[model samples]
Target: MKPSEEKPAIIALPKARRHTYYFLNYADEFKSVYLDTEIDMSEVKRRRDKLKLSGHRISYIVFLIEAISRVIRLYPEANSSVKHGMIPQMAVYHRIAAKFTLDKTMDGRRFVMSGIIPDSDQMPLEGMQKMIEYYRDTEADEITEFANVRKLQSMPLWLGRWIYRLAMGNLSRRAKLQGTFTITSLGHRPIQAFYPIISNTLCFGVGAIEDKPVVMAGQIAIRPMMKLSLAFDHRAIDGALAADILTEVKKVLEFASESDEASTQGEEVTPVGAST
Candidate 1:
C-alpha cells in the first residue's frame, strides 16, 4: 500500500461510557398532536370580500396572525425550548420563522422569514397581511431578487447546512423567547397533515376544512371543521401542558365565528337618531 494509509485512529470506549456520551450528545425530541376544531369560515370569507373591495387579498394571513397571537397569549408555556446540557428555561420572544414560497414555477423556492411577530402582545395583523400580499403578488420579482443575491445562490449544500446549524445554535434562545411557534397552511392542498420535522421548534399545520359534529352551547351540532397539528419539543414541555395549549387554541378558533358575528351586529346597529 502506498505508505500504509495510517489506519484510522481506533479509539474504543466501554459500553457504559459510550452510552453516556451518546445520550449527552442527543439534541432534542419532537412531539405532535392532530387537533380538530369547529371554526366559522363565514367571517373570514366576509373579511376577504371587504379586503377585495380595497384591492387587497390577505384574509387568511390575518386570520393566522390573530390565531397565533391568541395561542401565545393563552399558552405561554408552548413558546419555549430546552437549553442544551442544562435545565430547560422559559423563553419569551415574540418572533417566529415564517416559511414562504418564492415562485410558483420550478417546484417553488422556499425561504424562512424571521421577526414577523412584534415585541408587544398585539401583533400587526394588517401589516403582516400587506407584506404577504406584496410577496404573493410579485412572485416573479421576488424570484429575480433572490437570484441576484449571489451569496444565497452560490453557497454549497454542506456549507449551507453548517451555516444553518450555527445560526440556529446562536439564535435558538432569541427565536424561542416569546411566541415561538410555526404555522404552515397546507389546507389549500390535498395533504392531510405533516409530522414534526423541524428541530427545536413547535410546528403547527393547518389542514382543509371539513364538516363535523361538535358541541355548541350545550348540544352537539354540525359545523365547519379544520384540523390543527401541533408539534412540540417533548424535552421542554410535558404532555399535560401541550394538551392544554392545544385545547386553548381550539377554544379560540371555535368561538372566533361567534365573536365576529357579534362585532358585525354591533356595527350594523343604528344609534338613537341615525339617518336611514
Candidate 2:
C-alpha cells in the first residue's frame, strides 16, 4: 500500500459537543446492560404505508416513541432515575417523557441534539409529528436546551463539570434535563445494531430496516426487520424488568394494525409508593 501524499487534518472539538463529553463522563459511572433483538416490521410497515397513502406520514422513530411511551406507562419502573448517594434513591416519574436524538448542523459542521416530548403516552401520532417537526425546523442555536449546552463549552472546565453533575446527579433535575427514556436511530444508514451509553434508566437504539429471513408459523419467510438495541442502567432497574419492557415494546410494534388506535390516551400514571 502507498502512503498518502497529504497529511491528516486535525481540528479543534466543536463547542456544541462539550455537553456530550460531560454526559459521557457521567454515563461512565453507570453499570449498563446491553441487549439487541430483531423485530419483524411487517404489520407496522404496512400500517405506516397505509397512513402515508392516506396523507398522514409517520416515521419509524415516532412510531417507536409512541409504543415505548405506553410501555413505560405500564411499567413505570423503567421511567425512573437513580442517584447513588450515601442513601441511594430512585425517582420514579409519573409522566412519560420520550427523548429522541437529532442531527443538527452548526457552523458547517454536524452535531447531535435531542428534544423531549412530555406526556408522550397521551400524545397522538399527529401531535408527536408536529413536535418533531418543530425541533427539526428550528435552528439549533435557537432552542433553549441546545443553546445552553453550547454555552457550557465556554465555562471553566471545573465549573462546567460541577454544573453538569449538579443537574445529572439529582433525580428530579436529571428527569427534567434528560427525560425518562431516550430513543436514538440510525435507520437511514446500513447499520444493523449498536449499544450506546444510557443517560437514563432505559435508552433504546434503532437500526435500519432491511429484508431478512425470519421464521413465521414454522416456515421461513423474508420480512422487513429492524434491529432494536437497548441499554439499561442496572442500578435503577433489574434485568428481568428491562427484558420484560423490551419484549413488550417488540410485541407492540409487531402486532400493530391499521385499525389500532395510534395513541394511548389517559391521565399520567403515579406509581404506588414511589417518591422523589
Candidate 3:
C-alpha cells in the first residue's frame, strides 16, 4: 500500500453535517441557558407496567417528544432558528420539529445517529414510539444527518471544516436543514445530570429516573423522579421566555397521562407532584 493510502483520505461533505460542523465552531457569541427540573413518574410508571403486562409497550421518549412539542406550540419562539449572522435574525417555525440523538457501535466506538421527529405535537404516542424504534434498529439511507456525517468523516479534518463554514453560510438553507430543537435522553445510562450541546435556540436532555424521598401532602413519600436539563441560546431567548417554557414543559410532563384527554375534553385536572 502507498504511504498516503495508509493515512486518512479527503472526503466531500454533504450539507447538514458541514453546516453543523461550522456553526458549532464559529458561533462564539451563542449563549447557553442551563436548567434542572424533575418530573414525577408515578403515572408514567403505572402506564408503562400496565402496557408491558398486556404485551404493549411505549418508551418514555414518546411522552418526552410530545411534551416538548406542546411547549413549542404555545411558545413558538422556543423553536425559532437563526436566519443568519454571527448575530442572527431569528426565523420562527410554525410547526415543531425535534432532533434526537441515537448511537450505534462500530469497531467498538460510538457512531452517533440523528433522529428527527416532525410535528410531534400532533403525533400520537404509539406512532412516536414506533418511529423511534424503527430508526434505532435500522441505518436507513433516508436518515440524512447520519448519511452526511459518514461522508464528512471520510475527508481530511481541515478540508471538512472549511467546507462546513461555506455550506452553513446560507441562511435560507440552514434553518430548513437543522431541527428546530434537540432532545437527548440518558435513560439507559446511570447519569443523574445531563447537559447537552446547544446548536439551535434550545436543547434539552432527559436524565435517569430513580426513586427518591419527598414531602407530599405534608408527609414523607417516595417517588420516582427524572432530572431534565435545558440549554438555550441567550442571544435569541430571554430568561423570562426560558422560564415560562420550562414551566409549560414541566406541566406537560407531570400530567402527561391526562394532558391529551384534558385537551380533548377542554377540562383541566388538578396538577399533582412537584418539580424544582
Candidate 4:
C-alpha cells in the first residue's frame, strides 16, 4: 500500500479548544478593585506610630494580608482552583501566593512566595506586620538564593508548555494543593494599573496610590487612592460572590483606619491648662 493511502488523516481540534487546553490550566481568573480613600502616607505614618505603641508595624503588606484574610473568610469560594476540566475546587489552605520581582538585569526574574498568611483566622495583626518587614528586608537575598537554586533549570518554550499541561493535569490531582487566592501588587510600578486578565485562580491587583478628592464624613478631603482589582474565573465564582469578597476587604481597610483613630485617642491626654 502507498504510504499516503496507509496513513490516516490527522485532524485538528478547534482553535478555541486547543487554546483553552494550552492556557486554561495556567490561566488564573483575576479581578482588581480601585479604592479611593482620604488616607495618605502621613496618615499611615501616624497610624503606624499608634500601632507601634501597641508593638506593631502597620506596613502595607500587613494591611494587605489583614484585608485579604477577611475577604477569604467572607467569600471562601474565591479561594479555589480549576483542575482537570472539573468544577473549580475550593482549597482549605487560607494562604496567598504573590510574585516578587528580583532583579532588572538582562534575565530579570521573579520569585513566588507561598503561604504568606500562616493562619488567617488566628493570625494576629502584629504577625502580619512582622512578615511584611521580613519580606521587605530579605526579599532581595531570598529571590537571589531561590534563583541560584533554579539556575540550571531551563526548558524550551514548547517543552515547558507540555510540562505545564502534565502538571496541571494528572500531577495536580495527586497534590490537590491550591491557595485561597493570589495577590499581585504590580501597581507598585509607577504607571501600571488596571490589568483585566483572568487566571485559573482568583487574582487581585494592588495599584499605585494616587491623589484624589474623596468625601469623608460629609467633608471633601484629598486622599491617597489606590486601585484594587479582583479577577476570578467566572466559572468558579459568580459576580455577586466576587463583589461580596471585595466589599468585605474594603470594610477591613476602613475598619483599620477607624481602629487607628480610636487607638490614637486613647493615648495620654494634654490637660487644657497644664504647663509643659
- Ordered by lDDT, highest first, the candidates read 2, 3, 4, 1
In what order do the candidates fall by TM-score, top score first? 2, 3, 1, 4
Candidate 2 structure, TM-score to reference: 0.89
The C-alpha lDDT values of all candidates are 0.49, 0.82, 0.70, 0.49
Residue-wise C-alpha lDDT for candidate 1, range 165-235, written one tens digit per residue: 45445445336322366565667776555443434446566777666687769999766566667766776
Q: Which model is ahead, 2 or 4, in terms of TM-score?
A: 2
Best by lDDT: 2
Which prediction has the highest TM-score against the true structure? 2
Q: Estimate each model's TM-score.
A: 0.62, 0.89, 0.79, 0.61
Q: Write the per-residue lDDT of candidate 3 for residues 1-276, one digit (tens) a residue.
A: 988669786765543344355556855546787887887877777766766787768887776777777777767767776645666577777777777877765435454566777776777667777778878887544555566655665567687777655655664454544568888887889998898877678888888999999899999899998988888888778987887777777876776554363121223323223344
Per-candidate Cα RMSD to the true structure, in Å, reads 11.3, 4.7, 5.9, 11.7
Which is superior by TM-score, 1 or 4? 1
Predicted structure 4: clash tally? 18
Better TM-score candidate (1, 2):
2
Span of ten consecutive residues with least summed lDDT in model 4: 263-272
lDDT of 4 by residue, 1-276 (tens): 988779786864332133334444465432333322222433544566777797665656456655565556545555665443445344333444332221221224443432244454445666655555565566443544334223223444455457655655542331232334556665557743644344434666667777778777999987766667766666566776766666656655554555433222222322223354
- Model 2 scores worst on lDDT over the 10 consecutive residues at 267-276
Model 2 regions more than 4 Å off? 1-12, 266-276
Question: What's the lDDT for residue 205 in model 1?
Answer: 65
